[model samples]
Target: MVLETITRRRMIGISAAAAGMALLPLYGRAALEAVTWQGEAMGAQASLVIHHPDRAKAQGLVAATVAEVRRLERIFSLYREDSDLTRLNRQGFLVAPPKELVDILQQSRKVWALTGGAFDPTVQPLWEAYSRHFSTPGASETGPSAKIVGERLGRVGLDRLVCSPERIELPVRGAALTLNGIAQGYVTDRVVELLKAGGIERSMVDMGESRAIGSAPGGRPWRVGISDPLHAETVLKVLEVEDRAVATSSPYGFRFDSEGKFSHIIDPRSGATPQRHASVTVAAGQATIADAFSTAFNLMDTATVATVIGNSEGLEAYLLSHEGKWRHIPARTPVLVSKAL
Candidate 1:
């Protein structure tokens, strides 16, 4: 996914806010450090940030964070054609996958069930088709027709995937898996666990929006401004979150065509890009679940999305449409204000 650039005004405002907050005595000891690392992981722009009381500790934390991301990337990335997942997709069943891969696959199955197929890693073929077609112009430009996309979607049933403590198998060949939806969040959780184990109290990490964790130092929650989907220049809302995770998914992130007709987020049920809502942000106890559910809710209809959010305990969601209208459901209602009001 393409990372949206933060505008000049937003950067200036954030700098001013940071400068003003830094004047406080408590903020004096906090060490804020950010690092950008390039690897063949997560397709593009995998990053990590750490805030702590000492530069040495922050450096160690960042090192551990990078190591963790690289470790997970080795297991989950599809960029490497020789990766375990690629082999599995080619060979149908993989015997004795590494312990980490097994655990992630099992957890992914749970999310698949919870979202009622809205979150499916088996959609990798669809992603592959679109990404390859769009990235390279005139590369056999055979778009998956409605029938073929439907067939692939039908094959995306979570029940088709089987796993045991010792082995994992895909019932069909060419059934690829992409952890783009959940792996980053898992990495974030791991890094947080690492920092906490090291006795670091507060921090913030944004792994391309899927994985954002912890709080700023000084006993205060991290302040995050939700970007306006249409304008990109303004923030729709500001959120105060401590010890929680937030994720946003939208068609605004990527489009396959210049006319902005084809989006990367394809609705599995319909085999089409979702046009119901421009974007959806979900806040939950775990960043991984929040990340998956945010993308799931974006593909769902209004009633389905509402039911999912309402039934979910301690989950908050915000939906923005193309017409500049917004809807706040459940826990987000208190923090979000309608511009119309």
Candidate 2:
């Protein structure tokens, strides 16, 4: 799927008032207007907010950052006709692939193994099947038949993918890869590095995923609201984060049917939609980790999620059930649960 088609699937929003309050104390100034740049990145609405005493310098930084984002998009965007990912998918193999592409493919393999195939990039074939099935006129409410799903499933496996510094290949003829699940987080982290290098001490970077650099200007944590997927107007909970990243995933973000049955998130193992929760939110030191786990956690149950979180350090999560209940990992991460007023 093209990144442009994903804008409607985003479910996280920054708390503007809270972010403003926390940023006011920067540079010991009584008040400071944040220099912000708002635009789209990897198909999702994105923004970069910076608190600095020099307006000119901040503006220059924002300009440079925007260029960085576009550059990375060319490497990761699936819909970009000339993107590295598209070439690999069409040719079934890429010789001397970009280092960044190799890096992410390898990272995807690690997450695939960690989640036990719950987060597979090779599921692009299945995604295509469902998209084609639902887009046709008078399509069946039952979705694609088992025979088609099984055929697609046969082509889904990270083991079938070959990646190295010298080459990357999709050995199976019909096999393809989509980095939509993790590319956003990967790009977010790369942008964070650029901002840090530009001398940004306190900022919030939302490039598909949200990551905070340092606490808000006054040392108070940045507040981010986790939206209720089923009820867009509701805030399931607000998070106080400092030097961390947060990502949320829900099948409701993009449903194939008008009745809310089939969703974009498919379980690689069963070719079934997620039926456990309304949404899953994860926080970690890196946006990449939070984003991938949030997507994978939706495919798991409470016990399985707990086991995964327990083994990963500096990781926490909040799960909102279909019944409107909230649960968090480790039981020590303070959360303010509330609805939009």
Best by the TM-score measure: 2
Compose the digit string of candidate 1's lDDT tens values, residues 30-106. 22442223333345544333444455665676677667767777777767667777677777777888777787777
Number of backbone collisions per candidate: 0, 0
TM-score of each: 0.78, 0.86
State how far residue 249 of model 2 sits from its true place (Å).
0.3
Find the candidate with the highest lDDT and give its number.
Answer: 2
Q: Candidate 2, TM-score vs. the true structure?
A: 0.86
> What lDDT does each candidate get?
0.62, 0.75
Report the error of model 1 at residue 31, Å.
Answer: 6.2
Q: What is model 1's C-alpha RMSD? A: 6.2
Per-residue C-alpha lDDT of model 2 across residues 24-75, encoded as one tens digit per residue: 3222223354566566766666555555556676676777777877888888
Error of 2 at 328 (Å): 1.1
lDDT of 1: 0.62
